[model samples]
Target: MGAEEVLTVISNVGIWRLLKAVGRSRQRLGLDAQRRRLVRSIVAHEERRRVDSEAHP
Candidate 1:
């Protein structure tokens, strides 16, 4: 299983050091970039939806 799966299965109960290490490993695995782009796309889509609603209502 991936680090995320293991963390979730274990309820993420642990020291900050372990979480940080998993995060670093995921970053090295290119997880960070995927998340960043997904977040940016979601934000842009939300902004567009808000603008369209305001223009019509």
Candidate 2:
């Protein structure tokens, strides 16, 4: 899933519960990898946008 999907799931389920589940599952959920995926997706998305927009404001 992409970052938006991950964020939607987290928002629906609650971050604390997700954290507890991750903790109890010995991290087999690969949350870190998912996080890395999210970060990369966000960076890639941002890179595709117009960088000049930020400079004018």
Give the candidate number with the greatest TM-score: 1
**TM-score for predicted model 1 compared with the true structure:** 0.51
Best by lDDT: 1
Off by over 4 Å in 1: 1-29
Ten contiguous residues minimizing lDDT sum, candidate 2: 48-57
Clashing pairs in 1: none
List where candidate 2 sits over 4 angstroms from the true fold.
1-29, 51-57
Candidate 2 accuracy as lDDT: 0.79
Each candidate: RMSD to true structure? 8.2, 12.0
